[model samples]
Target chain A: MKNRKIRGAYTQYKDNQVTPEDSYWNRRDFIKNLGLSGLAAGSMSSSALMATIDRPVNSGFNTAEPLSTENVVTHYNNFYEFSTSKRKPAEMAVNFKPGNDWKVEISGEIEKPGNYTLEDILSWTRVEERIYRLRCVEAWSMVVPWQGFQLSQLINLVKPTSKAKFVAFETLESRSVFPGQKRGVLGFHVLPWPYREGLRMDEAMNPLAFLATGVYGKPLPGQNGAPLRLVVPWKYGFKSIKSIVKIRFVEQQPYNTWRKSGPREYGFYANVNPKVDHPRWSQATERRITDDSFFGTKRIDTKMFNGYGEQVASLYSGMDLARDF
Target chain B: MSYLVYAAIFRLLGADPQEEMLHQLGLWTLILLLSGLSLTPLNRIFSIPKLIQYRRMLGLYAFFYLVLHILVFFWFYLDANLAELFDEVIKRPYVTLGMLATLLMLPLVLTSTRAMQRKLGKRWKKLHQLVYLIAILGCIHFIWQSKSDLNEPLIYFIWLVSLFSIRAYFARKKAQ
Candidate 1:
């Protein structure tokens, strides 16, 4: 596995050389091995159990890592088609579209703002394989080997102005492309045309948040934010906008999709802080996506900032997370 | 599940202890939602005059899955940090909707018994109306829960909309 070098390009040029089912089985094995080991010999209290379980799985390639194309495509999602519940995304997102002709638009505070196609973007940035521990705001998680590059490179190339205080993202809007966009089922109020999200100037520029074009060293499947998507590792999963088409650098805080819908529930800075409690549920713990069977059973503790305090903690220096939360 | 747990202990020595729990919870949620939806139709169609009997069990099961959902979230992922749970429910609308949908169902579940329903009277229907609200909220809850994709919630909403519309149509027809 180490000897092989996966392609570093976008556009689903062709079906993955390795089959999707193969990846799924591999991921299942990876999940089985990692999920049962520590939990088996534990007499720890609930709190202690959570701390031990919550740590992200940092294993090597052959040591049961669920970074295959199938696992990347099927698992790790917030898409709730099967159930409104957490597990729905993975179950329902399986039948999504996968193809070429996908493109991402770049605009806003840039001097040269235009529609830079997916192919065009891939031509510039070389895809680097980086396995990131994704922690959602809902307290669920997954360790994904994401294949993309620093978002700063794209933003820098655009030459954003000094007035740029944040980088706003927009996902593709096609009633045909996305079945949910056509049907206003969740709420008639939410716009189906363009789903948007924004990140702080520094957070957007952080090397951790990649403008992911691919996953598992291959092109991203349509189900998993195909073409191009944003991956903000530290914050909740929603912060990372998927299937993006527009990038706007703004002086003011852009209206995020969730925050705009319900300001009280969603905040502008959705950093994954374990200190705040969701009015209806607790964000204190999470379930790693890789744990297929026990994925629902094993709950792990959350860190202050998804365990990236050393890197992104200063961003929220004096801000009251609970109040903002 | 108990049998599976027992068998796994001896056979699949390294079986995930939490696997059955997760499956049971998931299946329970599915059954709860389905059964909860059936109450109105069952009462009207079948001679389940006291259809309310099943409401609590169904609602409680839904709540049960929700609890499992939250437990799995906190235990396996967040490590039981009250603050982080607070942050997520407060900071994320999808999580909020998910949370609200479950929480709203609580009072309905709590007050679902025959005695409580008798005590509450007309207020019972009013309170239980929360089920419709919860179903809607649950749909929204699931819809937003999806970070980008919206297919699952869309399907659920289609079914829910049809169900509600049918109920509305029947009610209007009955009034006439």
Candidate 2:
């Protein structure tokens, strides 16, 4: 509770400064729009946790114009320790330490593979704001204005080899930083630090896959994979691994966290395809987070690669998605 | 507790509270199923007699949630759009798996009563074994639902596998 103000400090990120008061009203409007009065109820009932849960769902976009250069660099997540619920990460990450001593290792099929500090990566590229629609595999979607650039441009500096068929990413695997790693929720062996994910060579090189440094148009927040993260727009949300510390361009496929746990369920290219339902639920429809409740809003049909067909559908054109999926 | 939680959710987020209520029911149902499945393992580890008593409630809750989950999907999500629902069930693997899991849970719930248990006698045990099958089906339902977001459901799968593995190893040991 002492550090609650830490979240309120609305320093400028790309000139998009949302005052604490404005954010508070925004949250109120969001809840009212969602038909949720839980914040007021929680306030009356003396439940701070529920009040927190009722926080304005960060669509991550600065709706007002001039494309505020003061974009908040970090997008706080709701990943909770109690469960791997979509919103849990953001809620539970409030107490996390924002360490400055972060160092990332870049290796594998690259010409120059070595350790690089967070500052090194940021110095390479100027952050740019782009509004993106994040469609979670759970059939929920949110539009966010993110700050970063094509990771390939940076990776190109390393000069990946011709044999570098796949580019795998990894995140720091620390219980102190990520409490979820400590629990035996899944049978993942902590052989190395930073949980891993990979993309096909071209996919990794694609302009759409951003090497994000900040979100909401500013420097990345500690809770939202501050310092750096990956944002693969066409894939499922998880593929955009956060809090990254390692980048390996390999000829062979990388041992991805989710895929290693269940290969039958999670494919390497976790693209958002309504046609390819996740054996347990249909992905044909997704709940848009911004829809006003007064209209009795319903799920809209999901498109292939989440409407990035023009840019990404060709990636899997020759391959049998059903079989590969 | 989850039932009360669902009621409270309905009271709070009034945007088709049934969907949210049903979502909670489905989640808790899976949790209880995993808990129920863990009974044998817990019994094996601690030799506790009381754990088995809760299995019935847990299994019934799983069934309860499954029914509610399906009803909400059909009524609210589907919205009496029978053709669309039918098309989805036929075309979508996830929807099909969900339906399959729900349909399989129906028989188990119907025969869950003390009268049915007494009437079936030896056959009741055979009938109840269907829970293991239901659990597997439920897991498939979740796995498919996850797409590739396997973090949560993988935990359930791991727990379910461990529980069933313990039961299997013990059964083999007992036979030997």
Best by TM-score: 2
Error of 2 at A44 (Å): 47
**Per-residue alpha-carbon lDDT of candidate 1 for residues A164-234, written as tens digits (9 for 90 to 100):** 89988887766555655554444442343467899988888766778776666566766567667788777
TM-score of 2: 0.63
Tens-place lDDT per residue, model 2, B44-140, is 8899988988988888877777677776677656655899789878977767877787777778888988999999999999977878887887777
- Provide the lowest-lDDT 10-residue window in model 1 chain A: A56-65
RMSD of each: 9.9, 10.6
Candidate 1, residue B108: lDDT: 80
Q: Write the per-residue lDDT of candidate 1 for residues B43-155, one digit (tens) a residue.
A: 77676878857766777778877788678655544557788778777777767776787788779877877899899999898888878877777777666554444554577
Q: In order, what DockQ does each candidate have?
A: 0.14, 0.18
Per-residue C-alpha lDDT of model 2 across residues A65-125, encoded as one tens digit per residue: 1111121112214332223444355456666544434588999988988898655555565
**For this target, which candidate reaches the highest lDDT against the unseen true structure?**
2
- Misplaced by over 4 Å in model 2 are A1-83, A161-163, A183-194, A217-223, A291-297, A314-319, A323-325, B1-20, B27-67, B75-80, B84-176
Task: Give chain B TM-scores in order.
Answer: 0.77, 0.85
Alpha-carbon TM-score of each model against the true structure = 0.60, 0.63
